[model samples]
Target chain A: MDQRSIADVTVLSPTGRIDLDTTPPLQDCLLPLTQVASAKVVVDFAGVSYISSSGLRALMLGAKAARAAQGRLVVCCLNPAVAEIFRISRFHLVVEVQNDLAAALAALSSSAAAAYRHG
Target chain B: MTGKPIHMPRLRLVGQAAEIGPAVDTVRRFALAAGLPPESCDALALAVDEAVSNILRHAYDAPVDSAVTIDAAADGEGIEVVLADRGRPFSPLDRSPPRLEGGAADRPVGGLGIHLMRTLVDRIDYRREGDVNRLTLSKYRTAALAAGAPRGEDGADDTGA
Candidate 1:
């Protein structure tokens, strides 16, 4: 429904349709936070049942924002239907994905923290 | 308040997978009217359904009471389909692609809706117009259509009929 920030990471969990009609709220929410703080970003797709090009664009923009901020963005808890989409689009290569919230958080924290910690 | 109609196509439905058949047929008729080939027509219909189905399922949580509009027409060499609704804006195209771990057979049947739309249509434009959400999908007819491609119609697959 919305992307929320918690524990230094931004979580974007979208429910309902994610086509041309319903992508803006999530984009508006995640893009700014990723840009400003460069915090670790994890998108929970558990509730998202569909993905369209407009939805793909939103994620692309978010990934760009995370990259620009020197932060990392990841995806987790994708349903099988949604996961098929990632495979077809080859988005699996560009984004980090995990099986659940715990893994996503761990990956987000560890990878992002390591990057910042090392630099 | 202004009294102007939405200036879109007349919308009619009550929400059911049954509605998908009619909805796809209606959009296909519009596409055919605009001179699209059979294959293109079917693809467009599928694309429309994928969007509409998402609205039926995730938007309203079922196929009932939710309204969908089909305002389709020609824009130069391409056809444009406008699917408008009052659901919350939760674009799936805007999200990062998830990691897939198995084949299509092992996959679920939901998330592919948007992917199918993107694969079938040339361009997808989404915007908010007042209280409703509007999605515009465009596609150009291939050379095969200009060469007299078959004009097939989708069967009415509604179980209720």
Candidate 2:
């Protein structure tokens, strides 16, 4: 997983399969981000070819932790296969999903601005 | 249409979570060679991984080593994958799919693997014979392959009995 920070949003670009063998690393990567308050995360699935239920469970925990911390998690650029899994399991409803990175970043930026206005 | 011998492969692995990789790899290779679409191959691989993982996690509680066997065959229009385990008998089809109507904070963290398997594949059948539990997943050729061919089942049973 390659991670970079743009403004307040952390972008995680994980390549290859996110199955039983791979989800632990993904969890480690996302755990710290969800610990901080108001942390924004974007997982780019453009290079991910497949994701098993184990991966989904890890993401669910991360999303829940992030929510508890008042943070946000968004996923984007899912291939049709991965997207179908997300849709069927309703992970899309749990985590925000965008078509691409640009859209995700834009949504994050607007949400951040809204937060600033509310506070 | 040309007559070609269907490719069938049998894989056996210890019932361990780490062994799911090799099982999924074997299924993906067979699916690709059988002319399945890339997305279909990924879906099939995911289903196999979930099934094998469930066996490793839920089937055995004792220290005894167990085995999970997977048999795959293609009949020109679709592929049939059968996974058999000798551990305690449990049917994944009996579990209901998790409800998706709730928000993220209220959603449960597990139980989506079987739901994905049910939705991604064209057909799924579960049965137990004696001490073995068998789960069959079938994926039919969709837009990527020629359609409207009579479906046939290649009886390549590798239950490892």
Candidate 3:
């Protein structure tokens, strides 16, 4: 997983399969981000082609954490396979889903988007 | 779409969390060679991955020395995977589905694995044979896919081989 901060909105691009063995790192990297008040985080799945339930569970935890913290967690650029996992799990209802990074960035507070452009 | 088992590539591994990935990949390669469609293959792989994880996580007291046996066969009809573990007599099919109706905070965090294993494939069966726990997952090929030609070898990912 490669992470970078875009004007306080953290973008996480996780590559490869997110399975039982691979989910702990993701949870470690993601869970704390959602705890900050009004935190904005976007997980980019462009590099991910497959995911299992463990991964979905992590996302669920992130969503609940974000909700508790009054923050936002969005996921974008899911391939068809990964999208099917999300659909079957009904995770899209839990976390915001977007088409791409740009859309994900746009879904946050306009202040964050403005910061991205002007930074 | 239950066809007679053609050939079996039995995979036996130590029942540890790390072995789940290799087990899923082996079942996937078998499914791919069986001429399953890409979507069905992916679903089967995920189901297998979940099944193995469940066995490792729930069945064993300590999985270091235990074994999980996987026997998968792909006929022209569909794919069938039989997983056996000697750790415990747990039945995953007996569990209720995860509550998808609620918000994330209201939902439990861990039950999605069993739900995915149940919903991803067409059929799932569980049986306890004496001291062993066996779970079978089946995905039948559609009429078009069964009648169509096999996928090209180029489509196979080179990770496990």
State the C-alpha lDDT per candidate: 0.65, 0.80, 0.82
Docking quality of model 1: it rates as incorrect
**Tens-place lDDT digits, model 2, residues B66-92:** 578898888766888989888888877
Show the colliding residue pairs in model 3.
Answer: none
Model 3's CAPRI class? medium
Q: What is the RMSD of candidate 3? A: 7.4
Maximum-lDDT candidate: 3
lDDT of 1 by residue, A1-119 (tens): 56665567778888865655566788887788678765788888988865654566677677667776888888888876567656666666557789987778777676544443554
Q: Top DockQ: which candidate number?
A: 3
Query: Comparing 2 and 3 by DockQ, which wins?
Result: 3
Model 3 C-alpha lDDT per residue in residues A20-97, reported as the tens digit of each score: 888899999999999999999999999997899888989999999999999999999999999998888888888899
Q: Clashes in candidate 2: how many?
A: 0
TM-score of each: 0.46, 0.82, 0.88
Using Cα atoms, each model's DockQ against the true complex is: 0.03, 0.67, 0.72
Interface RMSD of 2: 1.4
